[model samples]
Target: MRVWILSDLHVDASPWEPPPGERVDLAIVAGDVADGLTRRAIPWLAQHVRPRARHVVYVPGNHDFWGTRLPDELARGRDAAIAADITLLNAGQSRIVEGVRIVGATLWTDYSIGRPKWSQAWGMREAGDRLTGMRDHRRIQTRDRLGSPAPFRPFAALALHVEHRDRIERILSEPHGGPTVVVTHHAPHPRSLPAGEATGPGDAAYASDLSAIMEGEHGPDFWIHGHVHASRDYRVVRTRIIANPRGHDTSHQRRDGSWADERENPSFTPSLVLEI
Candidate 1:
């Protein structure tokens, strides 16, 4: 019943070894496992991937899209000599593990396309290009003029909304009565300003759906995400919102060759241990 949540850890730094004998039932990697090309597999990755825990679940973040084939490729370990111990969750289908119905999607809110395009898997630039074109020109202008940066995006709003709801529906549609765990690479609900440790500008749709799911009788026990690059704990209705940003490399550089962690320092690493 204990789950460790981690997300947004850019692979520039290796994951630290968990303390010996410290038991974790499940590890939920929200996403952003690496920035682009995760060259050296963290010694811990292959080690802890299929830990003693009953299940280890992974979701893709926007950054992990860098050095890859289809977004789902990371889940499947398409590359030779590369193997991930955890179960990679991508769009489509409900996955059942350890008596839990787990459903996930790597889909982020696509602002430009005005819909959740599956193409975001083609790295950031290519996916961004596709999304940019999906935008509704008129709505873009209207939102721009009003200075209202929509969280779910206006043009793709209808499609994104449907996509979000469908994901929940898919999870609920599962025949098993076991409790479910929803994992995503983006924030699932709204938080106050100073939105500490959350995903970027398109998680509103997921957030909205999360609330609805939690309100229902068949709601998940917990919802975990990792896109924000920091660690935050909150709640969506009765669902506990756990976000862990795994990206640690800081883009901000100093003349003295020093950097800061993700939130402020250059060496912040996101690693959470969950027990399911």
Candidate 2:
């Protein structure tokens, strides 16, 4: 079971062409497949990888939620997943693929994760206005079709925690029958970040609880995530953490396809050719 893991494919810059001749059993896209409006990017990625891999699994990232309500975001994302003929794992969805129980979620960030320093990111903005750029403070809320008034902060650091707390808790508690795989858009654990990555305030917060879980006796056979654009693969207390990202245009991984020749940069896909 060789798997290709990619994350943060910020469309305009990132391009991925899997290595030819490699037998890919599964293709796992951690998150950030679109840039707010190009929702189709999700299904495009799925459709592209389907011919090569037996199964495709995906999770959603923050950018995927821009300008959309919680309900519509999930609905559209799930629909794209289905149309792409791929499995969509939102906050607490699980599926059995290739003999592994795959569990996935957005898991989100809570300001207290590691007491991150957001001193440089604070700001006061008007409601319903555009929240541009890539900062938590830049998240703006929009009206949902369900008429549920959205929170003032669209990307509030702890929003997902409050909304999907119970769902994630249940997922974390489920028993694994055999080799299991856990996937999330945010960093699963602090250590999951490579030496140079996972430095953002948001990353610090998102990695804490999940990182704590990786330290426990019961963890997944494989743990995967994106968010922190840098590509990193390491083994923690119990599981192997893989963060394979496509990153931006300047990213070394983007200069040349990582599939066939990763010699230019080993941080890209096929980070591991696990034959599980």
RMSD in order of candidates = 9.6, 5.4
Query: Can you write out model 1's per-residue Cα lDDT over 124-161, one digit (the tens) per residue?
Result: 23322434532222222212334454322333433533
* Backbone collisions counted per model: 32, 1
lDDT of 2 by residue, 151-192 (tens): 535245355655554565466577766677888887766665
TM-score against truth, every candidate? 0.62, 0.76
Runs in model 1 lying further than 4 Å from the true structure: 13-23, 36-44, 51-54, 69-83, 110-165, 192-210, 249-276
In candidate 2, which residue ranges exceed 4 Å CA deviation? Answer: 14-16, 116-133, 136-146, 149-157, 162-166, 193-206, 251-266, 270-272
Q: Which candidate number maximizes TM-score?
A: 2
Error of 2 at 73 (Å): 2.5
What TM-score, to 2 decimals, does candidate 1 have?
0.62
**Residue 202 alpha-carbon offset, candidate 2, angstroms:** 5.7
lDDT of 2 at 13: 42
